[model samples]
Target: MKSLDLSLRQKRILHIMQHNDTYITSAALAAKLNVSSRTIRNDVVKINEELAPYNARILSLKSRGYGFESEDPKLIESLNQIETAFFSKENRARYLAFKLCFAEEPQNLYDLEDEMYISHTTLDHALRDIASQFSDHTPYIRLIRQKETVRFEDDEMKKRLVLVEMLRKSWNYHARRNAYYDDNFIEPKVLDFIIDLVSSNLNKYNILLEDPSIVFLNLMIAVMYYRIRDGHILPYEPPIPKADTSVYYACQDILNTLTDHLHCYIHPEELDRLYLFITANRLLDQTTLTRETAKDYFGPNTRLIAEHFLTMIQNYFRLDFSDDDDFYITLLQYIRTLQRRSDIYNEQYTSDFVKNDLRIELIIAHLFQPLALQYLGKTLTETQLIYLAYCLCGTLENFVHNHPGDKLNTVICCQMNMPFLFAMKRRLESDFGNYLNITALLPVNIKNSFDFTDTDLILTTVQKPITRNPATDTLYMSINMTEDDLARLEHLILQRTIRKIYTASPSPHDLFINAFRHEKTGHGDPYSIFRDMAADFINAGFVTSDFLNDIIRHEENSTYAICPGVAYIYSLIPAEKSAMSILTLDHRITWNTHKIRVFIMTCFTLEDMPITFRLANLFYDEAYDLPKIKMEENPDVLTRYYLSFIDEPLTP
Candidate 1:
C-alpha cells in the first residue's frame, strides 16, 4: 500500500502536537498557525486517519480541543525530533531579532522580519507573547506596550528578570548554530519600560527612587540601544551618564565581601565614568533607580547590582569614593545631561601634540564636546585620556609577564625605542592621578613571549650577551656590549635585563632577534656575531637546535650579509613542540667572510597570507609602511628604530 502526502494544515497540526506536552485546543492551534479553528479540526481528523498505522491519533476530551497520542516509543521519538527541529527554527528567529535590537548599530525591523519569513504583524504578535511572559505593573508603573515594544514596570522587577532570563536561555540555544546573535535587542526595550515607569512615578507621585542616577543610566542605555539598532551610535563616542553615589557605595559593599574572602582589596572607583562610557547609551536609564527598583528584578532579598559594580571597581582599580563626595556629585550631574546635551564639565586642556595630529579625528570630536556629550561623556580630562591610554598599554604589558624572556619572538618598535619602556611618564601620571603601580615594567617586557618557557626576545637597540641557565629555565644576555667593550657592556646589560618577562604569544611575521646593537658603530648582523656566541644560544636551547646546519648554509650563501653593517641569517627549521627559545648578538662581529655586526636571526611559523606587492599601486598601504615611526630625529635613528621595537609587544 502507498502512503498519502499530508496537507500543509495536517503537517502544521502534527508539528504542534509533537512539540507541545499539554493537550492543545483546536482554536489555539488555529491561532498559532493563523488558520481557522474549523480548518484545524478537519486537519486533525485527516492526520488521525492517515497516521493510524503509525499509532498517532488525536483525542478530543470534554474541555480540551485536541491532542496527539502515540504509545509507541519509536513514534514518540520521531515526533520529538520533528518538534525539536521546529522550535529550533523559531528560537533562531527570536534570537536574531534580539541580537539586532541590542547591537550598537541601526537595525531595520522590516529587514529582520523578512529574513525570519514572518509578516510584520505576526512578528509583533510573537514579540508580545514573549513580553507577556514577563509583564507586570505597580502604582504609576504600568507595563508600557507599543506596537513593537514591550517592557516591565514598578514592583514587577521579577517580570523583567524573567524576560532577561528567557533571552539568555534563547541566546544559549542559538549559540551552537553557525550564525549567532547577542542580547542587544532585548536590553533596550527592557530598560525603556523600567525608566518610563520611574519617570512616571517621578512626575506623578513626586516620589524619586532612592538611587535615581542608576535609573537614569538605565534609560540612557535604552536610548543607546535604539541608536545602535538604528546604526547611529559611534564606536569611540559611547554614551555616558552620571552614576549614583548610592549605587557606587552599594558596589563597594559587594567588593568588600569579596575582599573578605580573597584577602585582596578591589577598588570601587574603577567602576566610574570610563566603565559607563563603554556601554551603549540606550542601555541606561533616564531617571534614577534604586535598591527598591532592583528588588523585583533581582529578588526582594537580593542586594543591588550597584553593590557588585562597586566591588568590581574597588577590586580592579583600588578606588574608593563615598556618595557625598565631590566626585560623586560630578558623576551624577554628568549622567543626567550626557545624551541630550553637553554641559556637565569643561575641557580643561588640549595637548598640543594631540591637537596638531590629524590622525585623532574621532578624538577631536570627543574633546570639543561637553563632558556629558562626548563618547560616553565629554572628552576625558587630559589626565583621564592619558590614563586610559596607559591602561590600554598596560593590558598588553600584563600579557608579557608570564613567560621566560628567552622564548619571546616579536619585538614592538615605538618612537621611544624602549620595549615595555615608553616615555609617557607625565601622561600616565596625569591620567592615573590617584597613583598606581604604573612604573612597574609592562607585562610583555617581564614575561617570555606568549609561550611560558622563555623571554628570548630582545627589546632594545643595544647588543647583549647570549647567556642562559637551564636549571631554572632562565636566559642571561649582555646587550649592545661585546667582550672587548667590558665597561660599557656591563652598563648596557644592566639596563637591558628585564626584571620580569611577561608571557605573550608571537604574532604573525613577528621577528625575534638573538642580538641587536643600540649605537650605529655599524656592525649588527647575523653572521657578524662570533660563531662561539651563536653556538652558545644553540647549546642553551635558545635558538632552534637544528640551526647549526642552517648556520653553515647561511655562511656559504653570500656571508648572509643584508647590508653594509647588517646581516640576517634565518632558517625555516621546525622545533620540538615544547621548545622555547630566542637569543641575540647585538654588536659588530667579523664573521667567516662578512665584517657586518648588525644581525637579526628570525624563526617564524607564518600564520597569515604572505605579502602580495603585485597590487601595490592599487592597495594604497604597503607592507613596509606598516611599521610605525615616532616623530623624532637622531643621528643613529635607524639603528634605534630596529632596537626600540625589540621589547615592544606586537600590536597588529
Candidate 2:
C-alpha cells in the first residue's frame, strides 16, 4: 500500500515528466511510440493508478496536455530509482505531435518509421489510428493525415477555441484539492511580451477588458503563440461585414507584433476571431458595437431579440439597464456572437457552482425563456439564460450599490384596517425616510399576483408567500410593530446602511493558521497578545510592523468586545495589505479591565470593512458561547463551528 509498481512505459512517462515541465500531449506521445494516442492515454490511466499510493497523479491541462503533480520529494526521486529503456508513450507521443504539428514538409511513412523507431507495420497502424481520430474533420481543416505526412488546414476561430480550452480546464482526480501543476505552458518571456503587447494596444484603443477577460486573452495569446510556433498555422480571412474598426485594427496591431515575435504567418480570419474575442469580452468608450451597425455585423433578427430582452428586464426589474450604454453595447455584441456560435456549434457554458445556480437566477430563467421563444423562436439554454441573468444581476447591483442616492421602490402589503394600515405606512416612511419609495399599497384582500415583481423589498404583515415573485426578498412584521422589525426592514431596503456590516469574509479558521495566523496561550496582556498575532501577519506579508503600533493605539482608545471573553479589533488599510489574525487564550486576559479569552483582530481596506462588522454581529449573537469556543481543543470541531457563522447569506 505504501509503494507502487509501475510498468516500463509508465516509468518512462514519469521520467519524462520528472525531467521536463511542459505538458506532453497524447497525440505527441502516440506518434513517438509507434502506437495510437489512445494506447498512450490508456497507459497514462494505469500510471495514475500506480501513483495513487504516492499522493501523485497525471494532470492534463486542455491545450497544455499532460504533466505530473506530486508534493513528496521522495516519490519524485523514486522516478530515477525505476529502471527504464527510455521508451515512454509520453516521449513517443511528444515526438509525433512535434513532427505532425510543426514539420514544414509533408510527413512520409518511411521517414516516420525511422524517426519513431517503429516497424513499417506499426507506423501504418499508428497513422490509421491518427487519421481515424480526425475522420469528422471538415475536409481541409486543422490536422488531416494524407498518404504520408500530416497536413494542417487553417481555421483560426475553431483552432483558438479548441486551443484556449485545452490550456484552461484540467482533468482533476481530486476536485477538492488545490493541486494545480504550474507548468509554464509557454516560455515566460514570450507570454509576458504577448500580454503586454495586447494590453497596451487595447488600452490605446480605449477598450476596457474585465479581469476574467484579461486572463482569458492572455491564455489565448499563450495558446496561439504555442500553436503557431509548433507550425499549426490557422490562416484567417475577414468576413464581408466586420466589427468595430477600432477593435479590429487594435487586434491587428497586437497580432502583427505577436506574429513577428512568434515568427509565423497568420491569416486575416485569425485576426477577425481575435477581434470577435475582444468585442465580446471588452467595453469601448466610442460605442463601437452599437445597435446602429447591426446590419453589417449581427444576424438579421439579433437587434429585435436584443431589444425585447432588454425590454423584459426593464419591465420585470423596474430598472432601466438599457440606459447604461455599455450594458447594451456589451450584451448586444455578446448576443450576436452567441447567435453565430449556436448556428455553427452547440457548445454550452456549464458550471455546477452555487453562485451560478442561484434560486433568483432560476426565476429570471423562467421569465426569460418565454421571451426568447417569442423573439428567437427558441428557448435559451440554462447556461445562456444564466449568463443573461448575470448581466442583469450586475446591472441591478450597479443601480443598488453604485447609485445609492436613488430611492428604492418597495411594496407595502398589510391586512389591517385603513387607520392601522395608514399608521404602519407612516411608521415605514418615518423609519426608512427618503431611502424608500412605497410604490404600491396592496390590501390583504386585493392581493393577486403583484407581490413579487420589479421591486426591492416586499413588506407584508403576514407570513404569506408570493407565488411569482422569486427574486425579491420579503420582510414579515407582526400586527404590533417594534424597533427590531423597523431596523430589519430598513436593512433590506438600504444596503449601504449596513455598508460596514458584511455577512462574512475569509472564514475564522482560515484567518488562523491558513490566511493569517492564530495562537493559543495563557500569556501576556492585550498589547502583547496583539503584538504576537501581528508578527505572523507581517511575516505572511498581510500587514506591516506599523499595524502592531496601530492596533495598540486603537485598542488603547476603544473596545471591540460586545460579549464576554471575546474582543475583536479592526481598522482600514490598503486592500492588498488587509489581513486578519485570531488568538485564543486558555484563561481570560484583561484588556482595559475587560477580560478576554478570545481576540480576533482585522486590518482591511475601506471596501472590506463590512466583513469586520459582520463578524462582530456573529460574535455578539453568540455572546454566551465565546468561552466554549476558547476551550474547544479539537481544531477540526472548532473550525467547523466558526465556518457555520461565515456561511450566513447576504440579501439577494
Tens digits of per-residue lDDT for model 2, 1-652: 1224555555556656654567788866654443456878888888788777668888978867888788884445444232212154433433454345445566787887786788877665654543433333312235565766664444444545543433333212122110122233456577668768877998898888755466567767777767766666664344735658888889889888877777777667667667777777654344455556645665657767667777765444344566665566656665765554421222212232322223233333345555555766655654465566665555544554445456566677888777887787788787665566677778766667564566756778878764345445567887788766776765555343233223235534355445443546766777777778777667777677776765564444323343345666654333344566666776766554446676667766544444553454445443237457645534345455666544432232
Best by lDDT: 2
Task: Report the Cα lDDT for candidate 1.
Answer: 0.36
- lDDT tens digits, residues 1-652, model 1? 2322454345556655755688878766764654567887788777788777777677887676676677773343333222111133345434543443343444455765766676777656655544443332111223354445443332222322333343333121111111112233435445545455434433442323323233333433344334434444332333334554444443344334434643543332333431342222222342444433434323321232223423433332222323323223223323333333322121212222222221122121222223212234323433333322322232222323322232233222122335424443333334322211232232333333333233323233223322232211122223332333333323222222221221123421232232332333333444334354345456656555456665554344223432223333444343221121222334445553333433334433222101111111111111122123212122244334543433343221
Error of 1 at 291 (Å): 33
Task: Give me the displacement of residue 607 in model 2, in angstroms.
Answer: 43
Q: What's each prediction's TM-score? A: 0.18, 0.37
The reply for model 1, stretches above 4 Å from the true place, is 1-40, 46-55, 59-97, 100-106, 118-652
Task: Report lDDT per candidate.
Answer: 0.36, 0.57
Q: What is the alpha-carbon lDDT of model 2 when measured against the actual structure?
A: 0.57
